[model samples]
Target: MAPTPCITVDHLTVNYRDVQALRNIRLTVQPGKVVGIFGPNGAGKSTLIKAMLGLMPVVTGRVSYGEGTLARQLDRVAYVPQRSQIDWTFPATVWDVVMMGRVKKTGWFNRFSAVSRRLATEALERVGMLEFRDRPIGALSGGQQQRVFLARALAQQAEIFFFDEPFVGVDQKTEAVLFKIFQELAAAGSIVMVVNHDLGESITHFDQLILLNKELIAAGPRDRVLTRDNMTRAYGGHVGFFGHVA
Candidate 1:
């Protein structure tokens, strides 16, 4: 059977202390596509994902992954917040971090099953961090740290992936690795939505581009969303140069 219900955001609106963060946003995300959320600073790019995930209270609208509400299906969702939002000071090994992904399946008080361990190990290997499995997460470099987290998400095996800012502080190799994994996930029929702050060549990786500026600007292929008018509307400048990523 075809993918049942497409992901839908219906009139999502978010408020921060009476200030409107997002206003009446609506979009649909199909499975097996890597979607990129792009916008200027303070344009609610991050807020849109949080609101859709039910992490933040939405003043209006709802998000549906299929026939059911998305927030209610938390187990099928995997979210990786920005690196800045994490505290690297916390002491935890790379293995420990990857194993955390299985907690939802294993239960808090229960021991991780052999299947969970295998999944974690495979995830580490996929991200090329298996050799550093015993290293403290805090001691690794920024790119290594991001890889470890990516491994954790891979272990989770979620249908819908939400990455707030996966490439905030990483090297070129790390960027390549992330895009590779993201493409792999999409090829396997997963929903990969990334909030990318940078609006450069990296946008090419996304199959769909969602341009935002406190509201919906454009949502479709890069050629449609990357227009000079849309860029000027989002960035508020002449933006004379706007071309399709391809």
Candidate 2:
């Protein structure tokens, strides 16, 4: 039998007032895998992420972790929100931001101690941002900011990670670096899932793809589920042809 999935969603549904954002969403994400969720704007991609984290209250159904529920296992997961969602002008150093990840592990009594500082440093080093650790977050470029957020997640040392639109405005070099970091995370047995919109080109970097258009259109290995037929179905049959990757 297949290894038990690290995360599972069963018959999940969400709504905003009378507007249905997600309808009967279901998926299982295995450990050490890189999964991509692709869809156009207003396709409920963000709603899925928010609902899983309890950022969006669900109207019906359940979101579970492994066989247990999401509420009990919040510490095992780390979230990296879309770059656009954050306020860059926040007065915090890169190191300070990363150190926030250790808050859960430090518990309620102990303050951030030497061990927490070390872990923060290590997370910055892992993301190649240690040299800029002292810099204020507002001083960094777009790519550097993205790296900092990732380092924050790394510092959490969680088994599962959720990234929303990580490549939205990154330079090509930053995109490449992020991909390398993702591969490393997966190799080390962590689940790395990202929500992206650049489907025609971004599918090459993913091992599995979950297509969404208010519901799960298709999900499986990249080569099997990202074909033209499925693409047409998901994107309304009028997508522009971007040349294939050689």
Name model 2 segments beyond 4 Å from true: 1-5, 108-111, 240-246
lDDT of each: 0.87, 0.82
Count clashes in each candidate, considering only residues at least 3 apart in sequence or on different chains: 0, 0
Off by over 4 Å in 1: 1-4, 109-111, 240-246
What TM-score should be assigned to candidate 1? 0.94
Q: If scored against the real structure, what TM-score would every candidate get?
A: 0.94, 0.92
lDDT of 1 by residue, 1-246 (tens): 455357899999899997899999999988888899988889998888888888889999999987788999878877888888889988899999988888865666642888899999999999999999999999999999989999989998788888988998899999999999999998988898999877667777888989899999999987788887888888897644334442
Error of 2 at 40 (Å): 0.4
Name the lDDT value of residue 175 in candidate 1.
95
lDDT tens digits, residue span 150-214, model 2: 99888888777899998877888888888888888888888888998885565688888888888
Candidate 1 lowest-lDDT run of ten: 237-246
